[model samples]
Target: MGLRRLDIDRAALLTALTARDEGLLGTWLDLRDGTLRALVEPDDEAFEARLESESDHYVKVPLFTREFRLMAEFVEQVDDDELAVRLDQALAGPSAFRAWEGVLAADPSEQRHWRAHRESALEQWAASWLAGIGLTAPWTDEVPAPEVPALLALVMDGPVRRALGSDAEAHTTYVRACRDLCELLREPFPSRRVRSASRFARGPVVIERSGRDVTIRLRADDEAG
Candidate 1:
């Protein structure tokens, strides 16, 4: 299958993965472009149901370390010189974390350089590594349409479900929890800027744009607007 560019909210997705929040497995994303696709493996009802029932701790799959040697064999096949160097280092070591630790301990400057290098090549790495694992999900930063139902399902399963209880009264608790999650993942709209002023200000000071050349004067709460 051809590679598909999938726009994922990295922070939110990573949160679920790190927390072993298996609730997200069957969620779907309705994209801003009007296309709908499973955010994870949405159709895997059996897998998701099993996940909900299981209470085991989640472990990160060691994809890189396990495949390092095999991937190393194909270093010469890589077109990018810098990534090839990274691939070599990764292959020579037991894990990427250890390899990076050694590099940082040896030369702090090299650590910063590696960060920049990794960020620049993330798309390429995702494309290559995901393909190797038989997945076409290349990461992108584009914001997705907020499909509240699926997102709610993702964040409110397992522990949250049990905690809230299965009674009719639980719907209120579920809605409250889902609303909180949605607020956390909500994207800011209409393009605004926030500036911090005094300690007296209780929340974010948002400034929304108006007509062209429009300007607004701001003062502290003690002062007139």
Candidate 2:
């Protein structure tokens, strides 16, 4: 199969990626157009049915942690030692994030730096996640096509049928390979047999879908045109 490169929606992916609230209803990426549609109301049967019928085109977004970066981690990356100390100290109290925000708000330049720093990290993270799923980001260079699994080839493409011409051991191997692929796919993505993508085309990460197509843009990426 030819690798289909999609142009995805940037904002929607970023919204999912940068989400601090773990209490989302659910989110899915429509591969046909790279647009993400969130299921806000759990009982929306029409939307649920659409997702079910068109399951191949949609990938579910996993639960994410807001602790992608710790306050101390960001502080350590700061260029200024004094400011770093202040930032680090700010993490000591009850209103740590507020205190840290107070400091950054007082320093416009550093605040900009912090935002840029965080955004850059997020871009990289999102790009890596997408690339793992055989998608490309505009800023990233030379992403190869996705790897097809053994089960798809054996079951769908009739490789196991060909195994019938060979010895019993060969056919058994093929069956085992398909079983492994099934287990792998059932596993959690990255680790399991499933997972997610965000980046698309030569863009940052805005995801929009029209008809059977998706376009993603990176609105916050300074490097994205």
lDDT leader: 2
Q: Clashes in candidate 2: how many?
A: 29
lDDT of 2 by residue, 1-225 (tens): 323467776656767764545445677778778888777744678988999898888877643333324456788778888898888788877787788899899889989988887666556555656666667765556553444543444344321223233444543443343334433232212322211232211222233233333333333545542
TM-score of 1: 0.26
What digit string (tens of lDDT, one per residue) describes model 1 on residues 147-219? 3433334434321213323434344333333333323333211111121111111122211222211112222
Q: Report the lDDT of model 1 for residue 205.
A: 21
Which residue ranges in model 1 land beyond 4 Å of their true spot? 1-7, 11-47, 50-100, 125-225
> Global CA lDDT of candidate 1, please?
0.37
Worst 10 residues of 2 by lDDT: 192-201
> Runs in model 2 with CA error above 4 Å?
1-4, 20-23, 63-70, 142-225
Q: Which candidate number maximizes TM-score?
A: 2
The TM-scores of all predictions, comma-separated, are: 0.26, 0.56
